[model samples]
Target: MQSRPMPQVAGVEHRYVVANGIRFHVAEAGAGEPLLLLHGFPQHWYAWRHLVPLLAAQHRLIMPDLRGFGWSDAPHRGYGTNARVDDLLALMDACGLDRVTLVAHEWAAWAGFMACLREPGRFRHHLALNIVHPWPDHRATIRHAWRMWYTALWEYPLVGGAVLRHWPGFTRYILRRGVTGVWQTPALEEFVESVRSRARAHAGQALHWQYVLRDIPRLATRRFRHQRLQVPTTLLFGEDDFAFAAQSLDVGGSHGVDVRVVPGGHYLPEERPDLVAATVSELFGTMESHREEIVG
Candidate 1:
């Protein structure tokens, strides 16, 4: 299963653009309202391969390699949530997309939340996969921190990069961890190899480092805890995911976030792209219909 050859999508066009001072590789398909899909750490645009064809029929899909993953430029810095959101905003500007519906997985989910929080009007709706909200109950997260032991390994500056660059098995193991079904596929292989690159290793580690060193402290402040979500959001969590418990997912329930328990593991984008695409399509349609109702 891991050895299967993964082919590129038939009608998708691959292009590169300068955004946030770095060259970003993007895969686009169809033509309608733009649906931007942001991938998580150790993955890029290719993670959305299955969803591209599924949703491309009704909406234009823009899937980029973020900044440091896939074929995108891996600069020395800019791995923070704010930085990544800025990159996405700049990419939208470069592509002339004034607004977009966002579907993000893992780390990129954080960026999506931040983007919507900072500029609510920029996004129509957000569908987040397997990630807790940016502002969560501190007590709940602290108790479940053990599940994130793997992230601690990534927080280190020296050994983290070494593990990614030298040990390909590490990436493969992490991607396969806790996921159901045959773990290895062509896309999974490509993702494993991408993180094996030294550049990606550095950038990936920096992502975790920023979360631990910067974001965690910010979470303690009144500003971060009081920051409310301004966009309609649906957070899907895998029932079998070990990294996050159900408690963390429900922290923002009071703020109108819909937390659903989907059957999968941490890697929902790859393991269950069909579910992801269908869910997003339904959400998009619902949001559009509500807008139409208001106008009427």
Candidate 2:
């Protein structure tokens, strides 16, 4: 099936809620079982703009800008993993969702994993894109460094923001550089405009530092274990994603979790929305069928 065009879904709603002393901006569409989508650094809810409509057809999709990104309040403090987890929980409670299927990409993947570790029951399943659990393996460390150069740059107070703002048309250049292969014209424009929007154009780049400096290895070591996921989980990565070495995908699939390889690079959803939608639909369908079998 061809992926639907950008912003096809109408009546998109936005709201703000105070979570962990910081306000978060959330976007919502459809109504059914809740699916919470967490975007990585330098991006916001717009990352899921393509997948939301397809998933929203059968699920209520909640996409949040997260603290320190997008139009959300960006406080200088409480940007840690624990704080992000708490913010998600608070957002869910504010939305009246007791449990949700969580999907995350890049830095948001760590936040999603940390949320599961903190309260497994709160999440029904997890879908991770392009980010490996930061275990203490040499391969994983090297891959993390390769994919996360912006994190170090963003940590610098005045220098990072200055660099991003000083270079006119830098956002467009970065977006193009981050992905491989040709993208559909409209899709590429939408992605670029979303990044360039006033709400995100500047703050999004700054938030990258917060995600990078967080001790991911220490957090994953303390949290991610061999425990069985109470709900079905899947990991999706692009074959050409230069962000990490091949071994990075090896860490989390040992426990019957499904792994999906798609075409394109790190920005798979934007680059190949049709494939992403189909994969997610299939995974959710499989999970539902499995649950039905057990119940029967």
Candidate 3:
């Protein structure tokens, strides 16, 4: 319900826009074509901090704190991925964005996939970072499921809040371990301290809870099979990511997505910002030019 002071990132403009009945905190930077940056758990727009400076010059970056993270108003409800997807679509509408090049990390990457699938017109190109694709092979994922044990500690209702509140070390460990020793002092501290807020803790819990209860079932049921990713997408999977192993995705289901395994851990934005920025430029920059040519 209350927002804490956000650390100042040079040239990054922070504003609160009313969308989905909540005041979502958005961090905007750069110029040129629009690029939407959605972050993952235990992090907000700051997750894109490392990437912002890299991509700020050539492209406009619109980074938003998903419903309950960062300085955004963390309401009790609207924690599920579908709800987050809706929140983003509404946020874009409120901001007058007809379409954007999506650069999303972690769970937000998952939701970004869903958004592109449901409405291909909303996204020009997608650069998904360090998350499994929508059509994950159930058998392969289950084999790698143990890697996700950490989610249980923070996915439950009351237990997750207690973990974030009482023991900040656990949260710190999760943040640090996700990156391959690339994370520095203040970045980890920023995310850990943000989730320490009671409201933010609740928001974190609800986000994970929805994942465990709702999204997992959808994955098991092949719910996404009914949908297809029409947007041009490149899925960047970190080779040493703690959350997922080498995925065995369904060949039939993978049509538009191009999955590439890169060097690093889960946090590509921090560990491999160079690769992230280059890929963003390649995907978004080229697409913008092609669009201009067609329109011109």
lDDT scores of the candidates, listed in order: 0.82, 0.67, 0.86
lDDT of 1 by residue, 1-296 (tens): 01223348788888889988998888899888889988987887878877877888999999888887877888989988889889989998998888889999988998888898888888888999888776667788889888988876676998888888888787788788857766657767888787766788898889999888877777666345666677889998899887888786666477657889999998887788788988988998898899899999
List, residue by residue over 9-57, the lDDT tens digit for candidate 3: 8999988899889888889999988999998888889888888789899
lDDT of 2 at 266: 79
Better by lDDT, candidate 3 or 1: 3
After superposition, which runs of candidate 1 have C-alpha atoms over 4 Å from their true positions? 1-7, 221-223
Cα RMSD for candidates in order: 3.1, 5.0, 1.7
Worst 10 residues of 3 by lDDT: 246-255
Candidate closest to the true structure, highest TM-score: 3
In model 3, state the lDDT of residue 223: 84
Query: In terms of lDDT, which candidate is strongest?
Result: 3
Off by over 4 Å in 2: 1-9, 168-170, 183-207, 210-212, 216-231, 255-257
Sort all candidates by lDDT, best to worst: 3, 1, 2
After TM-score superposition, the amount by which residue 219's alpha carbon in candidate 1 deviates from its true location, in angstroms, is 2.5
Report lDDT (Cα) of residue 81, candidate 2. 71
